[model samples]
Target: MIPGQRSRPEAEALPPLLRPRRRERPAGRRGGSALVVGLLVAALLLALGAVAYLWVVSDAWRVRAVEGEAQRAQLVSTSEQLQQRVDALQSDLAASDARVEQLAAEKARATDLREARDR
Candidate 1:
């Protein structure tokens, strides 16, 4: 006979303490461990997805930063050009004003000389 295997007559012959009792359920667990493993895999996938998302976001930010810097440089260049043009216009206006004043003074002197000669 195999070890630990017994007919009912032999099992009944053994003292109660030495007898092996029947079990209503199996010893090992399958469902609980499988659920725990499934949860762990899901968590790992979620963490990896988050990392990938952050990497893409960071890349986009870098591109935007570079574009912003280029735009700022272009704006500064435009502002400088506009300021130079304004300064040139101001100088031209001053010269035109000076010429106008000289012509007005000459006209006044001519009128006084004509009136003196007539008197």
Candidate 2:
């Protein structure tokens, strides 16, 4: 009836697709929906945090395993080097023992020749 307003029949005459829709739920229900969404978001964040924690723990375990392998390798190399040194020392000792025995036998032969000459 007014200059700027359309009557109910004129408003209804528009197509259903162009009609303004009213919210069916009350204003109080909106808060409940928001709370549910917030809880869902929090649950998602918690799950993501758990995944990150597991990833970090797994990486730490892998690092430790690698470090352990490195240490084992170093120990094995050190043991081999030590064994080589021990073998070399044993060979040198054996050579020295042989030389000492040969000197002793030569000294005994010289003593026997001196005794025969004296007689």
Candidate 3:
């Protein structure tokens, strides 16, 4: 070492390029944490909206199923009523056929009697 100059440390003797710089805020920006929080809140709101839409869709499905069941029940009842009416009509038709047969026999007997008298 020279007589007038003091000795330097090993770290200081290294090149300035290897040294770290001081931390500083950006020149024209606000706090970055507020922006991140706002984004998180927006994401949360979107998730809530999705959940609500799913709930509504599920409820609608349930309502549709219930309505379908009700319609099926109504159809069954109507079919049963129609079947009863058809059975009653068939019974009435059978009675009418028996009456017509009796009337036809009476008419044939009357015609035979009248032919004998005319001869």
Candidate 4:
């Protein structure tokens, strides 16, 4: 009937060494463990997020590198083709110059023959 008395004294029936002991936890200690658990969860989530971000960024970089290589190869091929075209055009220009020189010499000879015939 007392305020602090238990209806059942089952623990008291046991020896003092065998009785269950209960010590009151401070308010701060009880909440401290929960705080630690919450911080650990947050840290876990942060780590996962970092891993996901790195994976995505790395994938993007790989894609960009592959695309860049392809573009470089295409540019190199185009440049080689242009160089071949330039070489061909240069040879044609040289041949045309040689023909012009030959035509000039023949004209000079024809003019000389005409002057001789008139004289």
Residue 97 local lDDT, model 4: 94
lDDT per residue for candidate 3 within 1-119, as digits (tens), equals: 88999965566667897655577778535567668889999999999999999999999999999999999999999999999999999999999999899999999999999999999
> What's each prediction's clash count?
0, 0, 0, 0
Worst 10 residues of 3 by lDDT: 21-30
Q: Rate the local accuracy (lDDT) of all candidates.
A: 0.92, 0.94, 0.90, 0.96
Q: Which residue pairs in candidate 4 collide?
A: none
Candidate 3, 23: how far from true, in Å?
6.9
Which regions of candidate 4 fall more than 4 Å away from where they truly are?
Answer: 1-18, 22-24
TM-score of each: 0.70, 0.58, 0.61, 0.77
Candidate 1 C-alpha lDDT tens digits along 1-119: 88899746687789998888886444345666777899999999999999999999999999999999999999999999999999999999999999999999999999999999999
Model 2 scores a C-alpha lDDT of 0.94
Q: What is the lDDT of candidate 3?
A: 0.90
lDDT of candidate 4 over 38-114, digit per residue (tens): 99999999999999999999999999999999999999999999999999999999999999999998999999999
Q: Candidate 2, which ten residues in sequence have the lowest lDDT sum?
A: 6-15
**Residue-wise C-alpha lDDT for candidate 2, range 44-91, written one tens digit per residue:** 999999999999999999999999999999999999999999999999
- After TM-score superposition, the amount by which residue 22's alpha carbon in candidate 4 deviates from its true location, in angstroms, is 4.2
Q: Can you tell me which runs of candidate 3 are displaced by over 4 Å?
A: 1-40
Model 3 root mean square deviation, Cα atoms = 8.9
Best by TM-score: 4
What's the residue-level lDDT of 8 in candidate 3? 58
Cα error of candidate 4 at position 119, Å: 3.1
